[model samples]
Target: MKSYSVKELLEKQPVGDVVVINGWVKTFRSNRFIALNDGSTIHNLQCVVDFEQFDDALLKQISTGAALKISGTLVESQGKGQLVEIQTTDIFVHGKADPDTYPIQPKKHSLEFLREKAHLRIRTNTFAAVMRVRSALAFAIHSYFQQNGFYYMHAPIITGSDAEGAGEMFRVSTLNPKNPPLTENGEVDYEHDFFGKETNLTVSGQLEAETYAMGLGKVYTFGPTFRAENSNTSRHLAEFWMIEPEMAFYDLDANMDLAEDFIKWILKYVLDNCNDDLQFLESRLLDEEKSKPQHERSEMPLIEKLKFVVENNFKRVSYTEAIDILKNSKPNKKKKFQFPINEWGADLQSEHERFLVEKHFNCPVILFDYPANIKAFYMRLNEDDKTVRAMDVLFPGIGEIVGGSQREERLDVLQQKIKALDIDEKELWWYLDLRRFGTAVHSGFGLGFERVVQFATGMGNIRDVIPYPRTPQNAEF
Candidate 1:
């Protein structure tokens, strides 16, 4: 009487062996068949019971969403759908979900509706498939870094410095809210705060990871990063998990190559390990997009799209070239763009990135050497002194999936850039010390983990890909 999972039971034909399985009833039909699932896999186990032999009181307890422990002999299914099923001999009701109030009913649910019931949404086939694929992808990320000799560094969540000089930060404070200590200039006294100074949630781990790379040769960080920007779009999340890998003695070209290869490796890994779950998601996407206009639907299947990325070469273009292309493109010439690309220094928006990746190239595109003023201060300034050695990887539907750049290893140039950008010199003194000691060429980039999951799963909203999406004014779960 060993406990077996539905995945294990389905995979193996234990024809005459009695196995104990515990799961929640997905659907109970005709007082005999119980569709049970344990979140192990997308497939459900069909448990057949004899109504004539079972008492009426016991049968009444087996309802949809009810948790039950069922012990039965596995047999070849006489049914048409699945290959195997369970013959229930004894049952124990662990918990019951009253159908009157259970939110996850057996029906097609809207993604928005499912977001509200985030705790129980995993019971659904779509979310379960997504999470399984997500797990596989996570493993693939760590595997790639570990195999390539990169130290997996854990950057602190609470940081004393702003990696991105944008100043969009969520403060970490333990001071009194109503009446806190004030300074001589009538400012809130941060000297008595948690860290004895102003501290905030880390916006990026790239800066800290660079410090490790200088010593370890190569380093990576996969952890939660926060932002206080209030972008309430389908693409924006206040909190996200990012994968950043830094390497010493690497130039911008080497950084671009690593980023491209890393993405392809993850895609191939998921395709190999999570085929069953990916197949379910592919079918889900096809059904979900059936009602949409034919012109708007994807030309290729989900799996084919992923395979295409792995098989093909990414189009690499410089920022100056991209600007020239955008300014003279059919969309810009015809004034169809939402924000028309008119000049070289204009920051590329989502619309522009999509135009380049989906329309112009019809493939993944990596744009590099961005205008220095448009990028972060840490990016290496080019010989022209106007552009930085920055790069962004844009996918067909998801614009800017990955972004990274070569660091300004020269202390004099970096200090000047920080000063010109009005960043505090004292705050980044240790970062500058890396340059002082032995800074050679170093480069890195970060890719949002949730966005990659969304792409792999063909999920529509970014919120749907993450387990508990922390968006603006929405932290309910």
Candidate 2:
């Protein structure tokens, strides 16, 4: 007899063969049936045991959350819903969980309650399925990039330059916090710090990946990025993973095409490969929305929503046009929008972005050519001198799923932008070198990895999809 994982045993279904398996018991019903799970699949393998044969101590150890090893013969299950069962002949208790002390029970628990038990939440069906899908999505992302002739680049985590220019980054230093060196101006002297100058965790890897793209022709980075934004919303996180891809000689149009195709491809992969987990998630979402009013419920099931994106073409509209639509739209005219859209050059919020995708367009929308003042300084300035070649991909549920642009390749224009923004040129001296020596047109985009996982899993809160979510003032695990 050989040990087999629950997933493998369930798939192979070798009836009449004796097998050995180790797993944590999910439930012990009537002292006869044991529901065994090994984090291999959402389903549990039912093991039938005759209580008369096992010792009283061993029988008591088969309670939920206890680890056990069993040797049994596989047979066709007399029970419904399951295909096969284990007829146990021997039992070994590896560990025991006191029923009164175990935090997880075989019952429905709220997401909020499970969040506090982050370390043991994976034993639940919901988190287990979400994590499995997250893993599949990660592998699919790499597969798509590799098959499309893109090199994976590893960007540095700590840097002296601000990539997003948002000035929201976690500081990385070894200096004493209570008393630190001060400069002549009475400011904290970063010169005496570990790096000799101020350094922080990178908020984005786009700037570094661009350097690689210029040399490698095409490159992508999938790594953890940090931000110090003090937002306590369900969508915000202090630390998250980012997927950024940069390509040389690609204009804004080419960038939009790549993003659209990439999103559709990866989503379709999940839809095809993760049917079981997705079905479970879809059912879970449907049950969750039942309490809400009819209007608040999703228009379609989770799987259908994903298929909608993969099947349909994203409607491409300009920022100017989107503003015009929002200005005259029913929401703005009726004073329903919280942040009303009035004119151009106004930054669009999540409400506006969601409106463009869900209400106005009824599909995924790609809004491009944003006003130069609202976008980052690195975007290519349009001929009108008022807008930049920046674009955002908006989905039905989430506002901005992806953001990218054709970078400003003109050395003079980039320098002027940097100067006007009051950024220290010394920090980005190496970045400017690429332009001075051999600059070519390049474009890239940053996609929030957790956001995608949340959308795919139909998980309402962004924190639930990630394993160990790091948020504002909440690092319990």
Candidate 3:
């Protein structure tokens, strides 16, 4: 008999057909029923076997979490629990998992416990479902961009320029940490570093992706981005994946449309293809508050929410208007924000963003034309001379998942902004050349991959969605 995948067997409904299945035993009950899972899906394959068919010695060693191969006939399961089941005739043991040592048992384990054993966390129902969703979302991301005629570009991991100018970067150097290369003034000599003249992990691929987008017409980069910030929070991670899509001849409105459409497509793909996995998560892993009603759990349930976002126009408010609203709102009615929620110049905190999308707008809101002082120098400055054409898409559960803006295509304007900001103009010669040669109205945005995963799967914490999460003061496994 040929080996069959769990997914294929379930879909084919091969009742009365003989098949061979191999996987690690999730649970072995009553010396007859065995739950086998290959990490192919969240749901495991349940098997029933006769004690007489196997040797007593082999049966004695077969325990929970043991790897096994079994040949059996597929049959309709009578139990209300499972769908397709196998009646086993022959059983072979490939490996054994000691119950005493294996941290993942049949019992319910908290997410905190799973985080400690990041190496083996995928064995649990929640992590398994999360991993599946993550994979599906990644495929969806590529599919959406490729279908829309966007070239995928790979940006350098180590670069000389800080794209975000956030000053949070992991220095890349082979020089000694103590008594390193120093200049005449006793300052660290970046010229002696590995890449020479200082290099650090990429904070964003936007600027590089723009170079290709301007040439290719439309380009996007999907890769790992590093940020060495020390804040320990549910959202901040030392290393994360980002999706940045840039396009030529596109304006701020067009950029917002792309973000909305792309997000909807991904949510639809996950809800449609990962139904079984989502259901497993909803019932066993996700919290009760996060679970949906039985009727709303169907395919595209989340997609419907996203569709509402795409069909309805998002509220566009200038940074000035947002500031006025915050300043005038009654203090008693306003929720406390981490950073002061005052006006146009201050960075929008998570609480303010959530309030705008979840309360004021009652949908995903696109806050555009932010104060130039708070935005990057590359953003196109509006005629008002105060705000730039920047947009931050804030969703209900996740705040500011997408951040992008129309680039300053005018070379003179860009150069002036760079000089005003005191940025090294020499290093950005190539960037300035793009504007000087054939500058066109262009826009792009960067979406946090982990945030999208958290939104799609209803995962509460950023740590739960990413495998081997790299966070501040935490790099276990």
Candidate 4:
């Protein structure tokens, strides 16, 4: 008489109780067994029915992908696969899916094929487990920040200032594109736009989160961020979620400490809470790697890889030292790197970061004190003036997992850096005011939510982890 989720029923194992369960039919076999799932858990509920008791017409309605509600008495399963199953006494068909037309069939479907059917892909075991783990990780992120005395802040999605200064942004305007207002010099005038000036989607919330951290002491933002870069790679996405935490009175070293500890805590939470989903994903990864050569496969199991990170201390190396190691390493010297690490100022690519984590150190590594020219304008300038107090946490196979820095707090020094980059001081006047009024040593880092999900789930493509991935020339779902 009471409806129960498969997860709850499985955990409680209310044997001999009459229970009502609502779910979509995964499979109907031999006119008796029905595999049903409600998207609450990865495991399906085995529903056994007596063929002679029900009309053939009613039994015909129970097909794969059909939504159904069934009331039955739960009993210990005589079958070996699962512990309990339902003895169906009554049935109701809420909806039916044509087996021929349903995109999500019982057979194996490619990840590429599933992406096209993004709306219904969650019905699959892989995506359902992935999304469940992703949901748990999101909760873990907020939990860590809240327990450590940090306030959650919401940064604006649309803004006039460019945080990254790369200038690749999706414009936000209500003006007519075909024929809009013009300036005196004949350029498109943004003065009369919706916000009365040019605005675009935010790339990072660090700048705005810094303002909140100045007053709040510790604050974090978990929200959507956009980038208009035209990258169609498996590792890139046009839109993604970022988890950024800003802390007042923290230096770059402290920032690195927080990043390492935060990542470990959230990962451990997933290991404990989402064991069923994680076990499924781990087995999936092992099967996926079977086609590849032995050298290409991961040495450790998926869960072990996560545990390795949580158990080990992240190796800390300066940018100069990392450069030295890469320069002398077999890959760089033998031209194995795709983007070769030539000099200290060269930005480290995914290959280089992977080398440091997977091959060189065999653990997570934190590289710091990047060259000023390669980093953004906001990082604190070191005493030598050549490098900024910036850091990036490199993970096994994932490369850069987190990036942050000790922000430039000295008003004069920050102004000099801003002028060197030729950024509009007027646009960032409010940001500069933080330093003018009550600036202290502050630091923060951003971890791409998708990247973390990819690593945790052992998902190969960045697109597979997100619900609806936005990529170059692709927004279908």
Candidate 5:
């Protein structure tokens, strides 16, 4: 008999056919029926076994979380919930799991508790569904870029340039920390480091991907990015994946178009490919009101809202317009934001971003041409000299899921901007050389992969979407 995956069994519905299935027992109900799952899908296969058919020793080993191989006949059920089930004829115990030692039980476990057992949390229905959605979303990302003729570029893990220019970096070195490599003048010496220069885990892959885009015309990088910021918010993660796409001969408008299209593609792809997993998420994990359609449910309105966004085109607005709308808003007129929102030059706060997308636009909104002073040095300065050609794609729930901009290709303008920003021009020689040789107008943006996953799955936290999440003061595997 050929071994069958749980997912395969569910699809094949091989009633009366002998099939072999191997998996860890999720729940063994009454020692006669076993719920087996191979981490293939959110649904588990319930195998009904007769105690008389199995040896006493084999029966004793069958327990929840135990690994087992069972040969059985599939039976179509006219039951309440499950579609198909297996009636076991032969059973073999692959491994025994001690109930006391196993952390997960067939009971409700809080998300915080599950984080502690991160290694074992995949066995749960919620985590399993999340993992499946995560996988589908990742594929969707690759597919979206690939279909658009974007070459998948692998950026280096260790980088010398601070791409975000945020100054938050995790230094990489094998040298002693107490008395690290230093010059005679007592300054920290990077010459003796492994790379023979200062190197840190890359904060973003945008700069490196730009070099490839200039050559390949269109390129994207999907890779891990590290941020050493000590933020403990539900949104912050120390290490996360970012999908950065760089396009040659593109401006801010073209970049925004790409971002919106990419988001829509991924959202639609996951919804189509992971229907079963998504259903499980909607029914079990998401709130009851959120589970029902907007035409039916009142509590969870985001579902209907997102469905509209995925189907329709996003709204595009300028920074000046957003600020003006916020200032004249009726609801938040008296509310004071952490970062003051004024005219064209103000940096939009998360609350402002959320309000603009959720209330004003009532959908995904792309806000562009932020003040140059608030943006990075690489962003192209607009003719106004006050704002840079930067764009941020804000969604209903999450704010600024994507951030990108057109590069300042003009050498003189870039050099002057770098000098004004006080960034060492000598350190970015290769970047400047791109301009020196053959620099064409290019644009790119970084989409927080976890944030995108959270949006697609309706997952509440950034940590839940990622496996073994790296957060501030939390690195437990």
Candidate 6:
């Protein structure tokens, strides 16, 4: 018999047809019913076994997590829940997972426990569903960019410059660690390094993507980026994936529109493609949030929250106005904020961003026109010289989903900013050449891919969304 996936067998195909399926046994109930899952879908395909026809040795080996190939006649189920089931006529055990020794069992395992067994976590329902959605979201990302006339660009993994001045970066070195090459003054000699200079993993691909956008008119990059910051928080990861899109001749307003549309498109794509996985995640989120206080829990369920974002327009406000609102907010008035919003140009924290999205606007909010000094030097300076054409899209659970701005296209302006910031002009000579040659108004944004997945799946920790998270002290597979 031709082997078929559990998902295909469960579909409304011809009943009574003999079909072969290969999968792991989720459960063997009363020695007659076998719940089998093949990772094709979240739902399991029920396999009915006739114990009398099989030897006790084979029956006893049909344990949870056991890999098997079962040939059976698919029939309409008379059982309570599922519509289709398999009457097993043959069984072949490919692998046996001892229930007592297997780390994953058919029970509710803690997320922390699952982390230690990251390799096997996919066998669980929750993690499997999460990974399915993650995959779907990734496909949606590529689809969105491709349909919008954006060229896909692959930025070099190893770079001699840091794209973002936000945090520390992981240095790429080939010199001997203990007795490294040193200069006459005892400083580490980077001239002897593999790249002939000090290089590190790219922190962002925005710079390279901008170069492509200058010529292609629109381009995007989706790749892994690294950082050396030692943040062990639930939301921070040392290694992460970033989605950056750069567009030529686009202003800040156009940039914001693109971001909003791109996010909504991905959300809708996941909704349409991964319905079963999304429903499972929605229920999982409800159960996980049960331990929290009523006020702290999300108002809408996971799927509803996603739909709400897709259906509504994000609220837009200026940084100056947001500062005013924060200064007057009840939390600021009662001195409940950890970092008080006492003055303009103060960087907003996660708490402040969440408050603006969840409480103040009760929707996604795009805060723009941040202080020039606080933003990157490449951002366009405003007329007042106090603010820049910067914007951040904040969601209810994900504080900063997207950050972008209008590029400083004028050659003189960019040169001045580069000098004032003390960045090596030689390192960015090609970047400046884009401005010197034929620079038009351009804009782009970077979205942390993991953060988007975390929000869509209602996952709390950023680590959980990624299959193998790379955090401060955890790199084990």
- Which candidate leads in lDDT? 4
Q: Report the lDDT of model 4 for residue 211.
A: 97
After superposition, the stretches of candidate 4 with alpha carbons farther than 4 Å from their true spots are none
Q: In every candidate, how many clashes are there?
A: 0, 0, 0, 0, 0, 0
Better of 3 and 4 by TM-score: 4
Give stretches of model 6 more than 4 Å off: none
Instruction: Please provide, for model 3 over 407-471, each residue's C-alpha lDDT reduced to its tens digit, 9 standing for 90 to 100.
Output: 99999899999999889999899889899888899999999999988877767789999999998
TM-scores of all predicted structures:
0.98, 0.98, 0.93, 0.99, 0.95, 0.98
Worst ten in a row by lDDT for model 3: 295-304
Q: Name the weakest run of 10 consecutive residues (lDDT summed) in model 4.
A: 336-345
Q: Kindly provide the TM-score of model 5 when superposed on the true structure, using C-alpha atoms.
A: 0.95
Q: Give candidate 3's total backbone clashes.
A: 0
Tens-digit lDDT track of model 6 for 75-105: 9999887988988999999999898898788
Q: All candidates' lDDT scores?
A: 0.92, 0.94, 0.84, 0.94, 0.85, 0.92
Worst 10 residues of 2 by lDDT: 54-63
Error of 5 at 41 (Å): 1.3
Q: How far off is residue 292 in model 1, in Å?
A: 2.1
Task: For model 4, state the Cα shift of residue 333 in Å.
Answer: 2.1
Clashing pairs in 1: none
lDDT of 5 by residue, 107-213 (tens): 88889999999999988988888888889889898988888899999999999999889989999987888999789999889899888999999999888888888
Clashes of 6: 0
Q: What is the lDDT of residue 251 in candidate 2?
A: 98
Tell me the spans in candidate 1 whose CA falls farther than 4 Å from its real position: none
Q: What would the TM-score be for candidate 1 when compared with the true structure?
A: 0.98
